[model samples]
Target: MTDDSSRAFVPGHVTGFFSVHEADDPEQAGSRGAGLTLSEGVTVEVEPAVETSMQLNDEPAAIEAVTRVLGDLGVEARVTATTDLPIGAGFGVSGAAALGTALAANRTFDCGRSENELVTIAHTAEVEAGTGLGDVVAQARGGVPIRLDPGAPEYGRMDGVPARSRVEYLTLGERSTEEVLAGNTDRLSEVGVDMLVRLVEKPTLPTLLASSRKFAREADLLTPGVEDVLEDVADEGGEAAMAMLGETIFALGNGLTRAGYDAEACEVHPTGATLEMD
Candidate 1:
C-alpha cells in the first residue's frame, strides 16, 4: 500500500556531554548525555521508486544511517534530505536524516509502525552506523534532553531542561563522528559519566554548560580554535564549550556574538521530529 509521497522534519541536536554504552543489541547501545534541540534542522522527502536511492541537498550520496533504515523497513524509495547545518559538525545531521527517512518512509509505504518503533529503528541505525549515540533519543524527545540511561526509545530513559533559551553556535570545521567513536574513549567516557550524573541531579541549562566546559577540558576534546573561542567567551562573561566530536562551539543566549563571533543562532526547539501533513 504505497502512498503518493511523504515528508518529515527533524530538529538538529547538539550534545554537551555524554558517556558511551555498547551492547550486542543495537537498540541498547546508546549514550547517556545532555543536549539541546535546534530550531533549524533537516527536512526529508520520500517518494516511491523502483530502486532505493538517496540524495542529500540534491547531491547523490550514501548515508549509512539512511540506508540502514531503508533496509530495515524493506522499502525501495527515493529519499532526499536538505539541511543548512554542516555535515559532521556535531549537529546530529546523520541521526536527523535517519529519523527523517524513517518517519517519511513509514508513511510512504503505509507501514503500520508506531512512533516508538520508528524511533527504535532510527536509533538502532544510527548506533550501527557509528554516526551518533544519544542524538536519536534527544531528537526524539526534543528540548534540552538529559539522557539518564542508554538505549533506544523503549530502553532509554530521559528528562530535559525545563527552560528554553536562544542557542548560538560556531562551526570551525567538521569532525568525523565515526572516527572519534572508534578511537580510545576511556578518559572521555569517564568525564561524560561524571557530567551526566551531575546533570541528572540538577537538570538545568547552567549546569549543562558548566559541565560541558569541564568535560571538554578534562576529556581533551577541545581544539585550538574551540579553546580560544571558549576563553574569549569566558572573558566576556559568557559560557561556552566544544560540541562533542566536532570543532564547533556552542553557548547560551548571545554568548557567541558577545565573544565576537559571527555565529549561527537558533531557539531551543520544544518539539522533536514530525511528519509534515500539509
Candidate 2:
C-alpha cells in the first residue's frame, strides 16, 4: 500500500536576532530571535514511490531538507511542496516547507517520530543549508513565537503571544538570507539582543511591530523602497515593519492599499504544523 500524507505550516517573520552562538553540536547553534507565524504557509505531500524525489516551490534549501529526511528514514518517496506566500520574502517559506515535509513524510512512512524529533530534523536541514535560523522553531510553535534560546525544538526555548491579530504584508522583493547572515553581524546582533529582551518582557503585537521597525533602522537593513513604503503606510495610520532578510513590509493594519501597495492579509496562526493521511 502506498501511503500519502499532507501537512500545513505557518510562515514566520523574524523581528530580530539576539546572537548567533555555536554549540557543541552544530544543530544546537542558532540565533535567538523574535518572530511571528502568519496564517498563510506551505503545504507538503509525501507518497511512497519507487524512487525518492522532491518537487519544491523553487527553494533549493528544501531539496537538502527532503533528501536528508528521506535518507535518514530509509524511505523512498516522491515529495511535492506548494506555498501561498512568496519564497525568500522573509515569510519562512523554506522553513515551513521543510517542516511540513518532515511531518508528512514521517506519517507517510509510519516512522512514529515525535513532533520534537521531526522539528529537529527540519531545523537541522535549514541550518545546514543556511536558509534560516529560528524560523523552523517559530513555525513549529506558531503564534508570535519568541526564540528565547537557539537551536532545534529540543535545545531551543519558544514563547509566544497568547492572542491572535490581523497581519498584512506587501512584498517589494527578495533578499539572500545566506548572504545577509554571512556578513559581519556585530551591530545587528547587539540591537537584536536588546530588542528581543524588551519584547519578551512585554510580549504584545504592537510592541513586536515597534521593536521590528527599530531593529531595521538600527541594523541599517532598510532600503529606500522599504522606507518609502513605511512612510506611506504611516501616513495611512498603519504601523509597518520590514521582514528580516527580505525587502517585504509586514504591516499591522489594512491601510497598505491606500498607500498604493497590494497587501495580503492573514491572521496570526495559533498552532503549529498539522498532518493528514490518505
Candidate 3:
C-alpha cells in the first residue's frame, strides 16, 4: 500500500458478442462472448475510513459495484475511481471500477484475498447491480478474451485470440445497459451463440470482427452513426463493429482514422487488473 492507501487499474473491455445466462445464484450468472481489453480504463484508489464513501471522476457517487465489494469484504473505506473510457458506452467502465475497487481494497485493508476471489467478488457485484455480465472476467484476463462459458470467474471458462493490435473507438453517446438486458434477448442469444461458435473455430482477429458485426446486426443494436462509421472503415479495408449495448463502434488498428473519423485509440491491454505499484 502507498501511504495507507492502495490503487489498482482495470482495463476496459468491449464485448464483440455475447449470450447471457441467468441463474438464481449471481455467481452462476454471466455471459459468453469475446472482446478486446483496451489499455484505457478505470483506476480506483481505496483508503480505510470511518465510513464508506465513493467519488467517481471527482463527483460524489454511490457506485453499487464499489459499495457491494466494500460491504462484502466487511470493511469501510473511501473509494475514488477515475475512468478513462466513456461511462455507460460499452467500454465496461462500471466493471473496471468494480474490479479496480476489489484489487485496491484488498491491499488497503490487507484482505488477503486471492486473485480469483477478488474477481469473483467483482463479477458477482456487477451481476447483482445489473450493470454488466462478462466484463469483469474480461478485464481480469485482458487481451482478446473468448468467454466459452457463462458465470463468475471461478465458475466460467475463457480463452483468448492469442494476438494483439491497436483498437480505435468512437462513442456518439451513452446508453444504459439495464434496459437492453431486461428486454427480450432470445434472438440476441441465438445469434450470439452462433457467432461464438464460429469464433471458437477460427479464433482470429478477422473472424472476431466479422462475427461481431454479424452478431450486432442480428441483435439490432447499431445506431446510424455507428453503422456509417463501420461501413467507412470497411471501405478502407479495415474491420469494425458496434460495441454491444452501446452506441459506440470499435475498429481494428487504424480503421477509424483511415475512415476519416477522429477516434480514441489504444492497444489491447496485455495484463488484467492489479494493484498499482508505487
Could you report the Cα RMSD, in angstroms, for every candidate shown?
1.6, 2.3, 1.1
Can you write out model 1's per-residue Cα lDDT over 129-165, one digit (the tens) per residue? 8899989889989899999899997889888889899
Clashing pairs in 3: none
What is the C-alpha lDDT profile of model 2 across 84-189, one tens digit per residue? 7877788887777778878887887779999899889888887877777878888888778888889997788888777777878888889998898888988888
TM-score: model 1 vs. ground truth: 0.97
lDDT of 1 at 75: 91
Per-model TM-score versus the true fold = 0.97, 0.92, 0.98
Ranking by lDDT: 3, 1, 2
The collision pairs in model 2 are none
Candidate 2 vs. true structure, TM-score: 0.92
Which stretches in model 2 have alpha-carbon errors above 4 Å?
Answer: 1-3, 6-18, 57-62
Candidate that would win on lDDT: 3
Q: Report every candidate's CA lDDT.
A: 0.90, 0.78, 0.91
